[model samples]
Target: MSLKRFLDRADESRRSLLVANRSSPDPILNVLEATFDDQPVRVSERAVPDVETDTVLLVEDGEVLATSPLSALRDTIVTVNSDLYRTGAMGIDDLDMPAVLERLDDVRFTLRGYPKSNTEKLLLVVVSRYIEGIAWQAGHGRHRASFQYLSRIKDERGTRRVYERLAETDVDVHVYGRPDWVPSERFDVTTHVGHDADFRDSWVVLFRPRPPTPDANAPDSPSTDHDPVALLAIETEPHVWEGFWTFDQSLVADLDAYVAREL
Candidate 1:
C-alpha cells in the first residue's frame, strides 16, 4: 500500500514540478553510440584522453542571491547564448528578490551552456554581493547508458534529497558539497562524479535541488530549518543486447526501489 502511494506522489510531483517551464526539453549529448552492420566497426573513446577527443561546447552562469552565491551550468554540442547573456546576469544586484525567486521557481531560466574549464570560475565571484540563499545546477551533454536509466519522474531538486540519504548506505558516494555551492566558482559546487567518471557507452546527467530562500511573507524563512542538500542523481544507460539493457539491472532496480521507498 505504501509503495502505491509513493508512486502516485512521485508522478504527481513530476507533473507539478515542471508545470511552469516544462514545455522545452534541451538535453546535452551524453552518449556516443554508433553501429555499422556492414563494416562492423566504429570509433569510440576510452583507451585514454577520452575527454579530449570529444570536442564539445559548454554553457555556464553564476548568480548571487541573498547572503549566498551560486552558478548554473549547461553543456551542449553547439554553442548557446553569446557572451553578453552570460556576463550580464552576474548576480541579482538590482532585481527584486521576491520577483527573482518567483522567476526561478517558475523555471524560466535560459540555458547558457555548461562550464568546461576553471576559468569561468571568475564569474562566480559576483555572488559575494548577495545577502543570502544559493543554488547551482548543471547538465552534462549527451546521454550514456548509465545516466539515462535513472528515475525519469523525479525533478532535479528531488534527486539531491535522494542522494543525501543514500550516502549513509552507499560507498564512494560523492555528492554536492559547500553547504549549497560557493562564491567565485563555476557552479558554486563541484560534485564528485565518482573516481571513475566514465560514461561513454552509457548516459550520465545531473540535477540539483531548487534553492531555498526566504518567502515574500517571511523574509528569513526557507523551505527547511537547515540549508539545502544535494540528494539523488538519476542515470540511464543502454542495453548490451539488441533489446536487453546494458547497465546493471540490479543497480537500476535498486535506484527505482529507493525512489519508491523514499520519494
Candidate 2:
C-alpha cells in the first residue's frame, strides 16, 4: 500500500509530532538559531491538517523521538543538519544517510514522549525495505535450503546445504555480481549473487556446467530459454566475465543433511 494509506492505519493518537521537514527554509524568528551547542529547528510556512483529531506519538529505530502536532506541520519546514540520519553505520555496504535525508526532504518522522494523563503512549515506525532483483537457481531448478532466515538473501556467504543440493544434482547454479536487497533475518541487506550491468556491487551464483535454459514459469516471463542472466528491474551497466570457480565450498556441510534436518 501507499505511504498515505499506511499512515492512515498507523495509529489514532496524534499527540506526538514529527517535524519531518528537511532542507533550508526561511530563517527563524523567536526560536533563536542556537550557535553550536543547541541546533535550531524551523517551522514550515503552511499548516498541516488531519481528518482525525487526536494526539499521536512518534518513534524511529525503536526509540521514542518526538511529539508532533498533526495540523501544524502541513508545509512547515524543519531545520536540521547532521542530527537527522543517525542510524549507526554498523557493517552496512552503503552509508548514504546524508543523500537520502536530503532527497526525502518531504517525508516526516513520528515523535513521542510521556503521556499527559490517562492515555497510553503508542509508538510507531515507518521503515521499509524494497526488493527488485532476480534469484539464481541451479540447473535442476532447485537446491537445498542454505540461506535459511538469511538477514539479507542478496548478501549470501559461507557454504550452505543449498549448494550441496546443487552438487548432488550436478547442476550449475550461479548469478553473477551482487544481488539486490532481499528478505534476510528480519531487517534488510544487500546480496552478492545478482547484478545490473556496471558490475560494481555485483553478486554471483557459480557451479559446474552452465545453468539450464529457462522454461515456462520463468522469472523472465513467456520468452523461455532465459539462462542464468542478470535480472534487474532497471537497466544496469554493461559488463563481461571470463570464468569463475567451479568448486563448491559447502560440500562438507551438506554431508549430514538427514541428521541436520532432524534438528
Candidate 3:
C-alpha cells in the first residue's frame, strides 16, 4: 500500500505513534526503529509481508523523516549545526586527508574536490591545527602544551597517524572516546557521557551506521519503489571537513577550554 494510505489509516486511530522502514537498515530508519522499539509505534518492512492491513497507518517520507513533521511535533530548539534543509546538500568529491597532510608545509592546502571518503581529510585538518597551536605556544615560551580531541566515532588508521604525530611534538594530547586498542601513554584520556559536547574551530567528519541484518523468523517485507541505499552518502557529510567543525559549538568550546586551562 502507498505511504499516504498508511498515514490516513493511522490518523483514524488517533495515536501519536510514528512509523519507520522495517526491512531497510538505513541509519535514519534504524534510529526510528530503535526509538520506537517496544513503543506502540508501527513499522513498514520489505522483508516480510505486513500482516496488519485494515486501519494500517500509511506514511509518507516527508511526513516522517523531514523537517515539517519534526517542527510540527516538537518545541523550538536552538541549533548550532546547519539548517535541516542544508543537510546532505554537499556533493562528494575526491579529497583525501592523508595525501594532503603528506604535502602540508606550514602553508595551507587547497581542495581540488570533495573526496569520496573525507574522513581522513577531516583528521588531517584537526591534526594540522593542533600542530599550529603547539608551535604558537612554544614560540610564546609556554612550558606546558596539549591538544584535546573529541571524536564521536573511532577510526584506527586515520587517527593512528594523528596520535603518532602529536606524540612526537612538544604538546601533550588528550583524546575522548579512545578505543581499548590505543595505548595509554600515547595521550591522556577522558570520559564524556553527554549526548553532545563542543570543540574548537576545525574540520568534522560524519558517518552513517551500517544497517541491521534481517531476522530469519520475521516476515519478508516487499521492496517498494524507494531506494534506501541512495540516501546514505548525503547523510554522512557534516563530519568530514575543517570548516564543518566551526558550526559545532560543543566541539569548539571544549577544545578551546582545554587549551586555555592545560596548555
Candidate 4:
C-alpha cells in the first residue's frame, strides 16, 4: 500500500488532551489549544481534584494515558519556533520532549508550513528530530530518512550536522531524496535517489533498533527494550502535509519493511 494509506489507517485512532485543574490564566490555555489547532486532537479543560494545577493529560477513549506539567509543555513545545531547528540553534540533544507530547505517538496530524502558517509544521519537525535523537542515542539502530531533495541535507545546517553525527556511529543510515545534489563521501550514508512521487512528497524518519544479543550484558548499552519509532508524512499540496508518528513496534516494522521492499 501507499504511504497515504498508512496515514489514513492511523486516522481511525483518536486521542484528546485534557487540561485538568488549570489554575493558569486564559492565555496559557489558549496557547495549548492553539498548538493542537487543526490537528486530530481535541483539547479541553476541566477542574479535577487531586490533580496538580495546569497539568495536561493525554486521554484516549476516556482513559488518561499520560500527563505532564503545563508549564513544562509551554516551555518545551509551545514557546518554540521552526528557525531553531533550521538554523541548528537547537541541537538534537537539546530536545527534551515532555511525556505528554511523547504520548502523542500513533496520533494522526495534518500540518502546513511557511506561507500557510508558521507554527503548524513545527510540531512535525520537533518529532522528526526527536526520532533522530533516539537513533543517535541507540547507536546501532537502522535509520531511514527522506528529505524531498538531497540539497536540503546540505542546505539545512541542523539537518546536515545530524546526518554527519549519525554517520560517525554504527547506525545503518539511509537517506532518500531527489537527486538534485549529491552528498559528499564524508557523510557515509547510503543514498536512495529518485525523482518519483514518493521521493518528492514523502517525509519519513524511521529507526529500528537491533535486538539485543542473548549474551550481551553491558548495563550501559542502549536498551533493546525500546520500541521502534517512525514518523511518516506525505505532502498533499504545496507547503501542506498529513501524517503520523508511531512507537508501535508492529507498525514500525511494517513501515520499515515497506520502505525496504518498495521505496
TM-score of each: 0.19, 0.17, 0.25, 0.92
Instruction: Identify the runs in model 3 with alpha carbons over 4 angstroms from their true place.
Output: 1-154, 168-170, 177-194, 197-255, 258-263
Candidate with the greatest TM-score versus the true structure: 4
- Winner on TM-score between 3 and 4 is 4
Tell me how far the alpha carbon of residue 130 in candidate 3 is from the true structure, in angstroms, after superposition.
Answer: 7.2
| lDDT against true structure, model 3 | 0.27
Pick out the ten consecutive residues of candidate 2 with the lowest summed lDDT: 124-133
Between candidates 1 and 4, the TM-score winner? 4
Q: What is the C-alpha lDDT profile of model 3 across 1-263, one tens digit per residue?
A: 11111112111221222322232225534433343333223433332144322111333332422112221111111111112212322111111112212222112222211343322233233333333333223322111211223342233343444344434554333443222334544353333221222233222221111234466777973332211100000112343221111213343334344434432
Model 3 poorest 10 in a row by lDDT: 226-235
Q: What order do candidates take by lDDT, descending?
A: 4, 3, 2, 1
Residue-level lDDT tens digits of model 4 in 200-247:
899999999988766556556554865699999999999998888998
Residue-level lDDT of model 1, residues 25-134, one tens digit each, is: 23222111111111111212222232222222111132222111111112111122323223433222332222211222211111111243222211111111121122
Candidate 3, position 27, lDDT = 52
Cα lDDT, all candidates:
0.22, 0.24, 0.27, 0.86
Greater TM-score among 1 and 3 belongs to 3
Q: What's the lDDT of the predicted structure labeled candidate 1?
A: 0.22
